[model samples]
Target: MIQGFVKTPEVQALLDRASGKTVEGGDDRLKAITRDLVESLMATIVKYDVTESEFWSSIKFFQDGAREFGLIVPGLGLEHFMDLYMDAKDKEAGQSGGTPRTIEGPLYVEGAPLVEGDVDLSDDPDETGTLYMTGQIKGPEGESPDGAILHVWHANSQGFYSHFDPTGAQTPFNNRRRIKIGSDGRYSFHSKMPNGYSVPPGGSTETLLKAIGRHGNRPAHVHFFVEAPGYRALTTQINFGDDPFAKDDFAFATREGLLPVPQRQGDSAYVAFDFELQRSASSDDEVFSARSRAAA
Candidate 1:
C-alpha cells in the first residue's frame, strides 16, 4: 500500500492553497466549503490509493456527462438525500405534519400559464388514457387555504415531458399548468395518463447505472409546487401506487404518503388527493427556492 500522506503538513499546505484558504478577498463560506471538500477528497484518494488513470477517468466522466447531471444526481440519490436532510432538520426544529416532499427530478419549467379553479392540461386529439386529478390545498389545521397556487406538470403517455421531448411533438406547456385555487381550495386538471420512463439508452445515466447494477427508471408521477399566503411553499409529487417501479424508483422519490392509487371512472382514470401545507415560519418559506429552471 502507498504511504498515506494526506494528513501531513505538506499536503495540508497544498489543500489550503488549492481551496483558497491561503488567499484573501474571497467568499468565506465558499472557501471553507472548498477546503472541507478538497480535504475529504484527498483523504479518500489516499485511503483508496487511487491511480492517476482512475482520477482522470472520473474527471472525464463528469466532463462528458455535464448535460445529464440533473438525471445523474437524482439517480445517484443525492437529490433525495436533500429532501431527507431537510425533513430531519424540520423535525429537529419541532415542525412536522404535512405532505412529504420528494425529489423534483429537474424537469420543471417556470412560467406556465395561470388559470383559476380548474383547467384541461391535455390537448392532443390523438392522445388516449384520459386522467382527471382533483385535490385540495389545506392548512395544517385542516382549513382550506385561501389564494393557494398549484403548479403541476407531468410526462405524457409516451413518457416524454413537454418542453424536454426530443420528438418536438408536444406543444409548449402541453401537460403543465398553474392553478389558482378557488374559495373551496379545490384544484383539478384533466390530462392524458402519464407513463413511467427510463433514462436515455446508452447515455451517461444509463452507463453509470449499468456499472452500479441499478436501473435508471422512475414511476408514473405528477409534480407539484403548492403555495399560499401564510403557508410554506411545498414541493412534492405523487407516484401512481400501481406502477411496478413505484416502490422501487431509481430516483428514490417515492414516499409512504405520496403513493396515490388511481380509480377507473368510465373511460378515464381519477385521482383524488389533498395537500396539507405547514404555516410558514418566515417570509422565505412562503416562496419557492431560487433554483434555475427552464422558462418558456
Candidate 2:
C-alpha cells in the first residue's frame, strides 16, 4: 500500500466515499438526489484541482452560509431557479395565471395576527412613507375567491425585519400582519413602505458575494402569501417602482407584474395589484406551504 500526493488520488478517494453512499431500502428519490449532488460536487473538485486548503476554506464558507441560508439562495439565483421550476410545473399541469411568483425568502414566521379586512403593520415614527396596498384575490378561473387569506410582512424603514433582527424577538410581529379576504375577494393593508435589505455586512454572505464581485442589496419590497380554499398558495413580493434598485435586486426577486404602480392619494402611496392563484387539484397542493410547515 502506497500513499502518493494528497492532491488528486487522495481527494478522489475522499470524494468517492463522501458522494457514494448506499442505504438499503431507503427513499430512492432522496438517495438519488444525494448521489447526484455528491457526484457533481466531487467532479467539480477534481476537475478544478481544488486543493486541501481551498476545500477547507469552502467548508468554512458553507458553515457560515448555513446561518444566512435565506440570503444565500437569492444571492446565488437558486430562489429564482425554484420559481422557474414551479412555473414550468404549473404550465405542465395546465395552470396559468397572469401574476408572476417570486421567492419567499426564509424569514417568514409561522403565524401573525389575522385582521378583519385591513391591517396597519406599523405606526413607528421612524418608519418611512405610508403605504396602502389594495388588491383582489382571484382564483385560477378568474373569479374572486371568497375568504382568501393574505399574510403580509415587510422590513422597517431601516431594513430590519422582525424575528431576524436585533430586538426582533421582542416585537416579533413588527411590520407583520395577516388580512382575511372579504367575500368580494378584496383585501387591503396600511404599512410603511419598507426599504430594501442587504446581507449582513462583513459576514460570510457578504464575503462570498464580494469574492464574486457582487453586492447583496435587495430593493425595497414587501412579502405576501395568499391562501384560499381550493387555490394554490402564492408566495410573492411587490417592489417599489421608484426604488433605484428595484430592477437590480441582489435577490433577483422583482418581477414586472409584482411591481407597485404608485398612485398618490393625498399623503399616502397607494398601489393596486390583483393576486390570481392557480386552482389546486388537491388540497395538499395548496394547503401545505412554508407558512403551514413553519407552523407545524
Best by lDDT: 1
lDDT of each: 0.90, 0.77
Candidate 2, residues 1-296, lDDT tens digits: the string is 12223336655566445544433565667666775777677677767788999999999889866877777878899989989998998889777765788989877887788887677887455535788888788876679886688988888877888777765432668788888877888887888767777889988789989999999988878888888887777888889887788888888898878777588765468888888887777878676454322331
Which pairs in model 2 have colliding backbones?
A: none
Candidate 1 regions off by >4 Å? Answer: 2-4, 265-267
Candidate 1, residue 292: how far the Cα is off, in Å: 1.0
Best by TM-score: 1
Cα RMSD to the true fold for all candidates: 1.3, 4.0
Supply every candidate's count of residue pairs whose N, Cα or C atoms clash at under 3 angstroms.
0, 0
- Displacement of residue 79 (Cα, Å) in model 2 is 1.2
Candidate 1: 10-residue stretch with minimal lDDT: 121-130
Model 2 misplaced regions, further than 4 Å: 1-23, 167-170, 264-267, 290-296
Give the per-residue lDDT of model 1 (tens digit) for 1-296. 54568878898899889988887888989999999999889888888989999999999998999999999999998999999999999999999999998888889999998987569887664356888998888998889988899999999988999999989899998889999898888888988888899999998999999999999888989999998998999999999998899999999999999999889766568899999999999999999878778998
